[model samples]
Structures are given as structure tokens and as C-alpha cells.
Target: MSEQLIQLRQELAENPYVTFDSDGNGVSRVLDVEWDFHALNQNKKIIFFGRIAEKYRLDIQSYLYALMQWQKKNSSSGSHAPVNSLIGSKSQLNILATRWGKSEFSLLSSEREWKKCTQTLHGVGNKGTCKNLASVINAMLKAGLVSRYVYKRDYIQWAQPDAGNGQAIAFPEAIHVSILKTVVEFVETYHPYRHQISAAMEKLYTYQDEMFNAKLKELGVSALSHMQMNSLRNRMSRITSQWPERKAIPNFSFHRSGVWLGTLLRMCFICVGLFSAARKEELLSMNKESYDDSLAAVPKVSGVSTKGNKGERICMTWNTAPIAKLALELAFDATQAARRYSLKRLANGYQNGLLTKDKYDAKRQDLESAFVSSDIPYDSEALINKTSLKFHIYRADDGFNMKEFNINATTEDVEEFDLLNPERAGSLKVGGGLPKLSPHDLRRSFVVFMVKNRLGNILTVKYQLKHRNINMSNWYANYSELARTSQLLMDTQLMSEFNEAIETSAVDAWDEIYNVSDTLSGAEGERIAQNKAERLAQGEEIVMSRSELLALVRSGDKSIVLLPTGGYCTNRNCERLCSLMDIVEAPCEHKVITDKAGKRLSRERDNLIASFRAINDMGDYANELILDARKKKIVSIEPTLVKHSIPFDSFNDDIKAIWS
Candidate 1:
């Protein structure tokens, strides 16, 4: 082997694709060419295959590069990007390698070579995979693994893909409200009789094996016999009859009972997803011990953030609504038998030496996951199938009686619902197939709802969604498309609320300017004060009320365009494309300097005076023009400070000494 290959091997050995949880427990490892994110609950393996001429070629450079990237992601501090993203970039490189008929790293010298290899590859026409491909190549170049002759600018100029799937589309407001209402009603109606429902499910679980065998024994049989079904129904009915609120129990059949339990479990998932804005993997990562209601007022749900945390099982907690607490509790109760079965099976597997210590520990950690899918023979595993959850969310309409749920809808909600769904609105039916919903839709909708209702902004949504930055939160909270189609925009009440919120924001800005100083400077500031004084002299109110200020804003008689330099630009139509930070040089007539702006001016004046003193001390005679300009700038700043009653140290004596 070459010396470089040997060195690469050593580096790969030192930095294997392995990661640990927050507590330093081993979570995942890459075995040879396959990475098993076992503890991460990722069922799939990210496999690396490098075959050429019908022989397995161990491309040590590519292998080491992939390992290093994975290490960078799953670092001790925290992950910067997800493992899947790494897998995706690697997969793109793999595709390029396959097409080029050689290792991709060896071919990265020029743009022509990259284009020649990637021209025929799928998705190369778009910037999505192409950008990712370029990123991988750039990383390789920067790491010195590739030729230094390659131009970084060649690949760095790829424009962002215009047609890529951006943030998930938020659900329509009517559908969003209806889904929440249905789930809430389900929780309210059934949460009281949870113990009885658990008992019934437990009884049904015991007979599941017998029922399965009976159906299997009879050829062409799709379901249990009528007599057998009735027997099971009667058994569960006996448990339901003891409920104090008997109305809580829906009309029960053996099959309907199972459907009800399944619906309840799925509803719990929906409730937590909608309220907490957690990702699907995070929600599925939840266990029976996830919900902490110790502080009843501030309940929290603990889950793993799989996106940015590499495959490390770091526990992240989200403060959730009270309804999430009830939903989690119900999900725990409903999955009790499944949890018991998984634990029993895990114990047996370990005792029989079928599972190693590492495997046993990993399985044990996931034993109590809140969502579980078990078979008739009692074999159970964590629920990770996203399609099953989507189907359940689509079928959620069947879980509740629409008539009962709609009774809680307000007149505005009803009108909005009717406008959105005219076909089934008056009948209170959901026959016209429900809109496709997903876990991500719930998260995006949560952001939109919070921002649109004026309950929060991108920062608050960032906290709720656990986004790494405000950019991502802003993407999720983008509701411009939804607003165009929403009935709320047409409703007078909603328009009024929107207007009030805008007016309140404007009023707060005005209050900051007016209340910051007794007197204001700048031409517009002087004009505004004169106008108010004239009104006061005419027997009008001396102090403007919030309502009057709002009217002024509404009438477009005054406007507040805040500048970055602690001032307001009151010019409604000055039409100068001016840089906000260039206020010192290009001062506009519409600028109004408040006390805050005066303080800023004071700092500028102090700095200029200090510069003049430094020039005088340095005996820099050639900088005489510079000294004169600084002095003039200071002279201009002092008047604003004096007018606003802001304190400043006078540098007139120093200026006189310098000139003399």
C-alpha cells in the first residue's frame, strides 16, 4: 500500500464512525462499510459501496473522508448537521463515482471533469443534489484530500435551486382548527375513562393470539367468526359498563374496540406533535418516562433531536400544553401491554444469549417508547413507520362525531369552516376525502398559527420548534401563501385584530421616540413638536393618547420608519435610497433624533474629539485637513446633544489649544 493510504487507514482507525449519547454511553457505530444508528432508532444503515471492474475496491481516501465528516457531525460538543445529510452527500458522491467509473475524489480537478461525470446523473439539472455534491467536493478539497489545483470558485457559484421542496406547507386554517378540535374532544371524552379503556385493551390483548390462530386455521377466513367476535365484544363491554360517565364509551364492537384503541394512541401522537412542534423522529423517540408533569403548570415532553444531533441520543425537552400531558398519559396506558411484552421478550433474548450486552442495553433503552406496534403473538417494537401515522391522522375524522365537535366551534370558526368546505360544512360531515396531513405539517402549522395570531414571532417559534436559528423558524412560519387563500383575511373581525396589532406596534415605536426626551432635534423632530404645541394651544389635549396616535398612523398623516442608528426617518416619500448607518455623513431632513440618538451622537462626538487629540499629540502635520474635518463633525453633533438635553464633555478648549 502507498504511504498516503497507510496514513489514511491510521486516521480512519483513530476516528471511527461512532457516537455517544449525552451521558457518554455508546449509541451508534459504523461497522466496516455499514453504519448502524441502532441507538438512534434509525432502522436503515448508511452503506458505502466502492466496486470497480467486478472487484471490491477499498477507496481508503473516500472512506476516510466519510468517516471524518461523520466524526465532525457527531462531536462531543453537539452535532452541527444530521447523519442523514452526511449520508445524502456521500450518496451523491457515490453516484458520481459510479458514473465516472472511478473514485470521485480522484476526478476532482476541474469543473469540466465534474460536469462531464455529473451531466447524465439524475437530479443534476437541479441545484439540490448538485449543491450537495459540490459541498462534498469542496470539503474534500479544503481537507487537502483532493488536488490543490481544483478551483473552489468553480463549484461555489451554483445558484440555489428554485424548485426544491422548501418548508412543509402548513395546513389550511379550517382543517388545522378541525383536527385540533377533534383530538381535544377525543381526549376530553375518553381521558376520564382511561383506566376502563386500558382494562378492555388488556383483555383483548390476552385473546389476540387465540383470535389469530382461529382465523389462520380456517382457509379463506379474513376475520374472526361471528360468535367469537361477539364473545370478545361482551368481555370488553363488561369493563366499559362500569364507567361513571357511561356516555364516554362509544358503541362498542370487538373490531371497533381495537380501532378505538388505535385511534386513541394515534390521537395522542397528534396531540403531542401539534402542541410541542416536535419532529416525527423526536416524538417516536419518546418513551413512557418522557412526560414530566411534576410542575403541573408547565408540563414537558422529553425526546431526542435527531436532525442536528448526529445519531447521539441527546434528550431534548419541550414545554407543552396541558393537553399533551393527558395525551401522553393515555398513550402510556394504551401501550402498557405492548411495553410489557417488549420487556419480557428483551429479557428472554438476553437470558438465552441471543443478544449481546450492547444490543440488550440499546433495546432496553427503547423498551418503554410511548408508541409501539405489537403482533398477535406479542412481539412488539417501537413505532417508526411514518406512513402508518399519516394514515391514522387521515382517519382521525372517524374517531370523533363531527356534530359533537362542531358544537364547540365559534361562529367565526364555523363560517371559516363553511367557506373552506362548502360541501360538508352544514351537514357536519367529512365525506369529501380529508386533506393529506403529515407530522411535519403539524409542526409548520404550529409556527404559522403562532405568528398569524400575533401570539409569537419567529423567535418564539424558534423556541417552540427547537430550530437551530431564526432563519429556519422564519421559513417554517412563512404564511404568505396561506394568508392569500384563508377566509380569515376576508373576515372583518380578523382584519380588525390585524389592524390593532399593527397599530399597537406603531404606537410602541412612537412612544419610544416621544417619551425618550422632553425636547427633540432634527428638522422633522422640531416640526412635530411645533405641530403638537399648536394643537395644545388650541385647547386640544396636551398629551396625545394612544388612540390619537393610532388615528394619526391610520390616516397616514405620520409614519415611523426606524433607523439602525437609534432614530426615526419620518420621510414618507423622500425617495432617497440611503444607507441607514451613513447617518453621520448623509443626514436626511426627515430624520428625528431621540434621546437614544443623541447619546449615539454624543459617543461619536467623544470619539472625534479623541481622534483630534491623538493627531495633535502625534504631531502629524500632514493630517491637518483630517483634524479640521473631525472638528467640524464634532461641532455639528454638539447642537443635537444640547437640544435633546443629553450630557456631553465639551472639547472646545482642546480645539482652541490645537488651532492656537
Candidate 2:
């Protein structure tokens, strides 16, 4: 993907609805949509003071002015008036500091006041929070807003560095690919008809119009009643029955099983996060109408992404992965429904509920302006709440009743609560039972599976993850390198068995690996058998750790490679060596045989020898077909029998000279 597309995809991953709360300062605040909007705003303050404050007053008017008000509210909202009222007034700043008890910009005449200011900070909060307070204080100093005049170095305890660098927590933890796949499957099945439903809606409006035109041309009739239209549609359906036809009915697993709507919604949330590899904020907060089916009728999710930019498209799924595209469509579908519901609910509360006309109209006007101002094709009554998902509160009692005054519930309390504390009706059995998964783990699972399905192609994973840098994505994928190596070894074992069945003409011999055949081995090889072979081979150990195991596998030494599976080496060349990092990890066709591998061949050779001899004794005059089949089977098993150690000289000159 191009850089522009990657950036767009990442931005599209943002949650669309901006939930707002007025912090008693006559300005609304947006929360939970950005990971660290507080710190992000703080950084912006630094730049605006140093370079942009005076130079770009227009830009600062909306952003910087609002930020100061927010900071003031955090410090002294209960007792004080608005923050801007005391901006350049030193007397008001001091009075504000007294009411606040501890302030970042508290006036400090002597050295003692600054020390006391920091002392009171740590007393009220832990080191972690104190660190944040110290940071804001420092910003005030740089912005030339601080009245404190003291040595900055003396505030050592309060201004100490964070506990650790954020590197440890940089990359997200991914769930198993199996669990993720199951979640995706559930989401797809749960809302399988979303696209069909949308298409049916569009078709409903246009099909009648088209039908009238067709009938007018063919039969000289221009109009049809609703009954006639229905009849004609049914007839068209029957006539096209012999040809290929698309059914509008849902044909997914959930429809058959009939899962609850809440469970379906929860799965849809997870599937979107897991498949998109988007940050938690991106998944939880989505545009009320994020799905666009304009691109060849495939739904593409679009939204405002909040990773280090304003109003940039965060992330989106392309035509590349069908499963991902479907997951996003369902999540967006839920969002569309939720937003419409919010609008109707809000308007009803304003019109019927006990509220002043002015208060009701304030919210009504806010929503109305959104529809009028934006390019989003919302009807004049779409309430895009700060949250895409909403949970209704209940009064504690013997009976359930939704809490009252919910119409005025702020964004802080009106969260997408289903993901946080989802009600469980069914068990996932991923591990023990599935834990209530966080949104971030879904993103991690997305990155991890992208790496796995591509077999450790880091670049492909990075692009899919939409990582700003490769390091974080690489850390997430490579964290379980040992696990990937273990899979490689398993692949080798499987391929070995596959080759064994092919060479010996016993097609079901390798069926033991899958335990599918009647004659398949249950516990094929005992630990004692492995131990005995190891003792005979001079106690050579299996490579264990990731680094050592990877080195041994790639060493290109005859001793380095283990005979985990039976060898099928002939026409082997030393020039070709396998890399541990390569996507193809199965046994090479031109494999080289070693002493340890010979042990497996010897055991197989004895089994074949016994079977051939027994068949020969019973088949002298049984039938021509049986005798010919047994002979051909013996011939197929003979070459591998020679590759293993045998009495070559004692055999006839024909066998001895066959090596040439």
C-alpha cells in the first residue's frame, strides 16, 4: 500500500462520534477518543508558546484557549470562575491558587513556597500522578504563564522521571489466532445479512420504478399497484430460478443457531478490532455512519483517526482481505443503528420529557448543526453521541428498571459498557473459559495473525498493522519467535510422514498424524523409544531455546538437523541449505540422510519386509491381481530400503550395482 493509503487507513480507524461534556466552563470536552489527548494537548501548548501563539492566533483561539480552560477546571473548578478571567492578572492567579490548595502556576515569592507547592502535590497523589502534575507545572514555566520564582532543581521528588521507559509496554499482546478466527467467524455469521439488507433497502426503492418502465415498454401499461408489483417481482424470481440467482436470505451459522443480539454486537466489536489491527480508541469510537459500499459494492469503513493527527483518516480495510471487510461492515452497521436510535431518543426526551425548552433545544440544536455542517449523509436528526455503543443504566432492585435522567448522562458515564463488562451467555472455551477481552488485545491478535498467516513476513505485517514505525510491529510479531520455530519443526514432521506414505505406496501410513485411518497409531512413538535412539546416537539433545534452536536448524551441519520424521534423502546436494526465517519450512525434496534418520527407515524397512514375506507365502495361487499388487508394492518400498543400511553385498549383484 502507498504511504497516503496507509495514513488514510490508520485515520479511518478512529471512532467517529465525538462525545462531549461541558466541564461547567461553558465549553464541551471530548474524552476517550484519543489515547493521550491530555498529553497531546500539553505538547501542542509548548509549540504554540515557542512559535505559534502570536503567529497563529486564529488556530490558538479554538485549541489553546480551550486547553487553558480545561487546565483551570482541573485545578479549581469547584470554587473558581472561568480560567481566562484571570489569565494575565497576577492577583487573581494567587487567589485562584489559594482556593485550589496546590497549583502548577501558584505564585511563589520565596524558595519555600515552590517547595511547599510540590510537597502538597505528592501528599495528595502518588508518584505517578505527581509526575504528571510536575509536567504541567513545567509547561506553565515555558509558556511564560508561571508566577512561581524558585529553583526548579529543588523539586526533585515531585519532578522525578517516570518509573520506567514506555518500551516494555509499547507493543500490544495478541490473542491466539484460533480464538481470533473463531471471533471473526461468529461476527460474520451473526450479522451475515447486513450487506444484503442494505442492498435490499436500495433495491426496494428502485426496483418498482424500473419494473414500471419495463412493463410500460412491453405491455403498454405505465402503472402498477403494490400488489401487482409484488406479483411481478415473484414472477421474475421464479423465471430466474433456473439461472444463477442471489438469495436475500441469511445463510450463516448464527442465523441457524440463533444467538442473542447483545452477544452478536460484542463479537462484532472484537472482530473489527482484531481484523483491522487498529488501536482500542479506533474500534470503540466509530462514525455513526462509517461504512461506504461505493467501491465495487464492497463496504469500506471510514472514520477520524486520533493517532498523532487531527481529522486524518486513521485505518480502513481494502479488497485484500474479505473477512476483515465483512467484520468492519457489521461493526459500522451497529454504529449506524446506534446513532439513529440516539437521535430519536434525544428528540423524544426534549419534546415529551420534563425539561426546559431552552435546555432541550440546546442538545437538539447541537445535533441539528452536526447534520447541517458535515458532509456525512445523515438525516437532519442523527444523534452521533461521543460513543458508538451505549449502555443503559439500571436501578438496583428486585426488578430491573432503566435509570432516570439518562438523557443528560455525560460521556464519562455513558461508555461502550458492553466491551468493558460484557454479559456472558455462552462459553468460548479459548482458555478455561474466555475472559472478557479488552479492545487492545484484538488489535494485537490482528498483528500477530497477520505475521503468522504470511509466515513471518514482517513488512506485510507492518503495512497491515499501519504502524508508524516498524519496531513496534516487529516486537509484537517476533515476541513468540520460539513458537513459530516449534511450528516449523512440526511442519517438518508432517512432511516427513507425507513423503513416507508416498514412497512406500502405503497411502494411509501417514494418516496416523491426523488419526483419521483405522490402522493409525495412537501414541505412535514412546518416550522410551526416543530415549533409546538418543542413547544410541551419543545422547544428542533436542535444541530448546529460540536462539539456539534457530541456530542449529540453520547451521547446515549434518549433525545439526534431527530426524524428527523419517528421512527421504536421495540426489541430495550440499549447496542448498534451509534458512530458519524462510516461509517454507517443510522437509526438502532432495533431503540429505544422516545416521539418526536411518533409525526410522530401519524400523519401516522391517515392517515392509515382514508384510511382503507374509503376502508372498499366502499368494502363490490366490489371484494374478493380488500377486502383481504385492510385487509392485515391494518394488516401491525397495529403494528406500536400500537408502537405509542393508546387507548390500549379500544381496544379488543387481542390488549391489543399483547405486550407480
Candidate 3:
């Protein structure tokens, strides 16, 4: 075996507790190993920094103070008794007098001058902070100005440098403390703080410092070289902020085919989010209760059905359910359409169960946007399945078949599949493969649309959008700006004459469009005046009341509704009918009928009763069919599709197609 491989084998043998797998790639080398002896041995002293820090449940700041006290008590000469050989006075504290210290190091300034400088620095009084003290002491030691020695096993004392060009020397206890401080600070700042941290413990910083120093020693680096050790710790602590977000809905455009597929998956997730609007963590942590599929329609979103929140967690999730439903259904439909059209597109689908995952202890996966391109997992071949028997057969329409679709699982299954074990969910089976979009953005888009449409109150918006902070849901404000401005404009007018002018101006513009003269001659003006008088005598069409219009709307004689009320039907093709009477009296068979109270009645019921009377004259057979169908499982006759065709002349051929 090669030297590197041999060294690795030795390392494995020495540290049998450590595990590594080489697979068929052959033996791998162990690059480095570090151990902390001081951290391991500190308990034999009067107090251990790690133990005190952990036991008291103190933060790093307070732990530093506790460590200083422990050091002071244990450093006295009489207290230097070693209970176990594991720890002796190998580490000790020393205070040197300025005059002797200066003479020993051949200082330009006396020790008194240095002490003055030290006193003025931060963390000089009481137990000085480790970082600050360590920095000062390290500078002094590097300058060859101070020295120290342990006179007894327990306590440290000062000493003069040996009189030679190559002088042997000792370091001050304060210098060691200073080094320890730097080490602790570095560890505390590490990106993922080393798991050793315990808020309950005292002297956390001190313990980390000792551990770091010991680690350096184990690596054959001079732990006594505080400057080098500090630099190394800093390097180890550094980390880059490359991963901007844990979950990313991928950034594919809505126009892309992948986007359609992605959007569908994302839409499903968004519906879940908006419907649940659970806290971010909770949303990610969701289980089965987050959705209800009891009806054929979209599931109702309710937080009462969610988990992870404290207290009753009872809050009504009120948002525009219709738009939410539309966006999701559209996304799903678009995806199904894309996959059905192409085999290559099928290959681009997301992994099955991508959104379904277990919540606990599992790593959160990336949330792709409504679209993403294909890429293999860089670290493993586990995701590849080309050789599997299931992979060779194409299933472009697996999830799209509603007749064969099954919605058997409950909230529990969703939770298990979606939140808990995301990795497992990521591996789910989909006929065409996973769609591009993920679930969370579906919720975000809902919030975006709600705000866009001005569909709900701020509280309702926040709940439906599932934002914890009201401020986070400001995206919708821009969409409602135009409507709000119009409302404000309508509520205020400078003068009644201005309103009349506005009305008059509209008619004048219409008159101008019909080629009516802007300036007519005397005879022409006289003719116009005569026509106006004649029209006034004849009287104009009657204006309907709000109740009358509402009745018409309810009756579905929506077509032929008046010009102004024409906007109500979202379907673009319906005729604009202003009144029920206009529809009923027209040649068209469709009629809007009203009761004596002027409320609308169902056309089906009215027609059914009429049919019954006509049928009684023929026989009891028809009545029996209706009765038996309702009362028992009788063989029912097939119902025919109703067609209502009107003559071409009856329609206002001049009117534009409503859909256009």
C-alpha cells in the first residue's frame, strides 16, 4: 500500500471509534486529526471551565467571568495539590513586578510604564476579558519584555530571562489567558457554532480557548505561539454565505413549458400554504391535517387542522378562495397539458413525492420555483433510475387520469410525505416525473394575487397569505392602488355643477360620434330642438331599481341585462341584460321570471311543474319514473343535453361578440 493509505489505516486503527467508507474506490488517506488535552484534563484543577459554564446554564459573557474566578482560586501556591496525576501545575498564573521584568528583558521603558499602558486598556480591572487581555499580553511576550515560571506545582511566579543571545524564557500567566480569550472568541463566531456550546454553563469561552490550544498542540503546532494559534482559529471559524435561501422556487418564466409543469406542482403547494398559512416553520413542518379533500372541489384551508403552534391555534383563514382555487387548478391543468404533449418533457418532470417528506430530523430540501431544468445529484447515484424496469415504460398521463385518481390519504399522510421526510417525498413515483413547481410558492402566489385583487381585509389577507408579520404581506398593495384611487375620486367632488357637466360631457361626446353637428344652422337647430321635444313627449325607457336588477341577476336572464350591469358575469360571452322583463318578453326561450315579491324563482322548478301538468294528461308513467328514481334505485332514463337555439334575426347582429 502507498504511504498515504498506510497512514490512513494507522489513523483508523488508532481512532477505532471513527468510521469511514472507501467502497470500491480503494483506501483513502486521513488528512488530519486534532485532540484537546487541556479540555480533557481541566477537571483535576479547582474548577473546570467547561463544567462550570455548563452547570450554571450561563451565557458566554457570564461564563467568562466565572472562569476568571476559578483561575484565581486555583492558582494560589498552597492550593496547588493535584488530586489526580492527570492534571498538575503545568498551567499556572504569574504576576511580575515592573522593575525586575524590565531589567530582565532589557526594556527601554520600565515595567511601571508597561503597567500604566495595561491599566488604561479595556478589560484591565477585576477579571479582564480574555480576548482583550490576551491581545495585550501576547504583544508584550512577543516583544521579549516579560517572563514567568512555576515556583511550586500549584502557583506560578515571575522569572528573569536567562542571560544569553539565545535566551531561554517563560511566558506570563496573563499572556496565556489572553491567548485563551482569542481562541474562545474565534470558536464562538464560527458559522455553525461548534456543537459544544451550552448556555447553561459558565466559562464557555475559556473552555473553548483551552480546547483550541490543545488541538493546536496535538497538530504539532506551537500552542505557546498565541499569535499563530489565534490566526489559525480565525481561519477555521470563517464561512461564506453562498446558500442564500434554504427553499427556492426555481426562477423559470411562466412562458416556459417547464414552468407550466412546475407551476402546477407549485400551485398545489401554494394552495396548501394559503389554505394553511401556517407559520414558515410550521408550514414546512406540516402533516396531513393541512388540507381537506372531502368534496370534489378545492380543499378548505384551516389552521385549526395544522400543528406546531401553541395555544388553541384557532384562527379563521379567510382569503379569496375562488382565485386561489383558479390559480392552483390552472397550474395543475397547464402541467398536465405540457406532459401529455411530449416524451422529452416527461423526462424533465420533478422527482415524485418531491413535496412529500417526513418532518423530523430530515434535511430540508431546495424548493424549486414553478420551473426547473434537469440535473443529476452531484454526490450520489441514488437518484438515477434509468435501469429500473419502471423507468423504461413512459407514463405521460399517470396523475392526469381523474377517473383512476385516488385521494385516500388523510392529513397524516400529507404531513409524512410533504414535511417530515422530504428526501423520501423527493423520491416519489410520478408517471411523467415530478413537475417543476414546488408547494410553498403556490401559497406565496395566492398572497400575491389576493393583494393584487384587493380580495380581503388586511387581517384576512395576512391569514390567507400565511404571513406572520403584517408587514411581510405588502406585495398586494400595488395591485389595489388603481381601485383605491377610483374609490377616493368617486367619494369627493368640488361642485354639483361639475357632476352635471360630467354627465352632459358624456352625452355630447356620444352625440358627436353619431355625426350630429357641433354647430347647426338656424333651421338645423330648429329641427334638432323639435326632435328633442318629440322624444321628451314619447318618454324614455324606465330605469330599474336595485332590487329589480338584483332579481334579474339571480334569475340568470343575465344575458340581455342592461348595458351598465353587463360587467357582472365573469364569462365574457354572455349578453348584457339590464332587466328580467326584457329577457322574458324577448323571442328567446330563456326567461327571467320573478315572484310577486319581485324575488327570482328557479327556472328548472317552474318548468318542471309545467311539464308535470302536461304529462298527467298523457299517463302516470312519467310521474312514476320520477318518484321511483327518488325513492329507490330504479333504472333511470338518460337525460338529454338541453339546446336552446334562437333565430339569427332575433340577436342584435350589430352588437360585438361579448367574449371579444
- Best candidate, TM-score: 1
Worst lDDT run of 10 residues, candidate 3, spans 633-642
- Highest lDDT scorer: 1
By TM-score: ranked, best first: 1, 2, 3
Give the least accurate 10-residue stretch of model 1, judged by summed lDDT.
Answer: 383-392
Compared with the true structure, model 2 gives a TM-score of 0.37
Candidate 3 per-residue lDDT over residues 1-660, each given as its tens digit: 334224433544543321122222212121122111211112121222232223222222121222322333556541212222111111111122221122122121345655543343322222222232343234334323333211221111121122112111111112212322332332223212111111101122233345666676677864336676566445433421122211122322222213223323333333344444443333322222333456536456433322212211343443233333433333323232222222222233323432112210011111111112212221122222211101111123442222222233343333322332232343223322222212333344344334434655567766665557777565433233443444345555645556556445433332331233222112223344456556546884323334454454345443222123111112226453533323334322222111210111123323434454455445455365543222221111001001111111111111111122
Candidate 1 at residue 194, lDDT? 66
Off by over 4 Å in 1: 1-90, 93-113, 122-126, 139-162, 210-262, 287-289, 292-298, 376-436, 480-660
Q: Count the backbone clashes (under 3 Å) in each candidate.
A: 0, 18, 46
Tell me how far the alpha carbon of residue 312 in candidate 1 is from the true structure, in angstroms, after superposition. Answer: 2.6
State the lDDT of candidate 2 residue by residue for 15-133, as single tens digits.
22221222322212222212212112111111112222233322222223323534545553322222222122222233224434533332443467665555554443334344444
Better of 1 and 3 by TM-score: 1
Q: Which wins on lDDT, candidate 1 or candidate 3?
A: 1
Q: Which is better, 2 or 3, measured by TM-score?
A: 2
Lowest-lDDT window of 10 residues in candidate 2? 398-407
Off by over 4 Å in 2: 1-101, 107-134, 147-175, 192-260, 284-300, 311-320, 328-341, 345-436, 452-462, 474-478, 482-660
Order the numbered candidates by lDDT, best leading.
Answer: 1, 2, 3
lDDT scores of the candidates, listed in order: 0.61, 0.38, 0.30
